[model samples]
Target: MAKPTTEVALISVIVALFLVSTTFASSDAPFIVAHKKVSLNRLKSGAEKVSVSIDLYNQGTVTAYDVSLSDDSWTQDVFDLAGGNTSKSWERIDAGSLVSHSFVLESKVKTMFYGAPAVIKFRIPTKAALQEAYSTPMPPLDILADRPPEKKFEWAKMLLTKYGSLVSVISIVVLFVYLVATPSKSSALKGSKKRR
Candidate 1:
């Protein structure tokens, strides 16, 4: 009786360990290794250039296939891929391997504020995986139109740039009007003496 009880306990322990190991193994499947960087570059024309770079690693023991990256807002007008179409693809990423992709996109500064999120999609023999990469808020562009003057000097510069000619013309007209309206002091004194 004692021997049978010991055997049963040993079997139960083995079964628990097996279950835990299988769960861990499944959880370690192919997934995004990391989001290396996402950044925005502001252009002088009040447009924004966006770049997203990411690394995809296969943590599982099997190769990943049909890997692609997508963003709903991505279009031919804005994104020009280095080689492929709207959805980037890789035939296969081997087990314990990493792949890097960089995307360059262009848009108006205002449009970037409503940009879409990026997603990684890949498939394995057993199933497909879709993961969302770490997204950074699109940085506001510092274009001349969007950024307000921070210093008094900047404000003065902006005003001069915008209204310099108008201001100068108005000043000239005011000076001419004053000169025509006011009689010379010498002329007024001469007339008064003549009258006396």
Candidate 2:
């Protein structure tokens, strides 16, 4: 009876290990990651030139199919698409690959607004349903603010304020090391007299 119980326990353990291994092996699905960046420049005609770019990466072992990117964070009344379309589609994104999309937006009105994250949709070969992901959200921005360019003196002042104390501390430490490492004049003269 005891021998039979031991065999049953061993069989169960082997079965559990097999199940765990298969579960890990079947996780070879495609994972999509996205990041969005926006840069604002004041155009000469008093309009805001907002250049937006989205970077997508596939970090899994399998390929993603029917990839679509949509970003409708800004409305037509507030902003206008100056260069590229807001939505894009791709046939496939292989593993360990990167894709990027960029669009230029132009706004004439001065406004402070918050933006939303872009949506990404893709399908895995083994899965029937589409998987959805989002890009990192952006912080609120004050477009067309009266921010003037810094002068040369202002740059110097900024550096001084940021590093003046650190420079002083480092100088003091070097001076202390020099004083400790070098013998004093009086000590050198005394040693010479003793030698004489």
Among these predicted structures, which one has the highest TM-score? 2
TM-score of 2: 0.67
Cα lDDT of model 1 by residue, 2-35, tens digit:
6744665576567546645764768755544434
Q: For each candidate, give its TM-score against the true structure.
A: 0.45, 0.67
The per-candidate count of clashes, in order, stands at: 0, 0
| Poorest stretch of ten by lDDT in candidate 1 | 135-144
State the displacement of the C-alpha of residue 113, model 2, in Å, after optimal TM-score superposition: 1.5
Best by lDDT: 2
Please give the lDDT score for candidate 1.
0.61
* Model 1: pairs clashing at backbone N, Cα or C within 3 Å: none
The digit string of per-residue lDDT tens for model 2 on 66-183 reads 9999999987887988999899999999999999999999999888867878999999877799988777666566889889775869878998999999999999999999999999
How far residue 171's Cα lies from its native spot in candidate 1, in Å, is 52
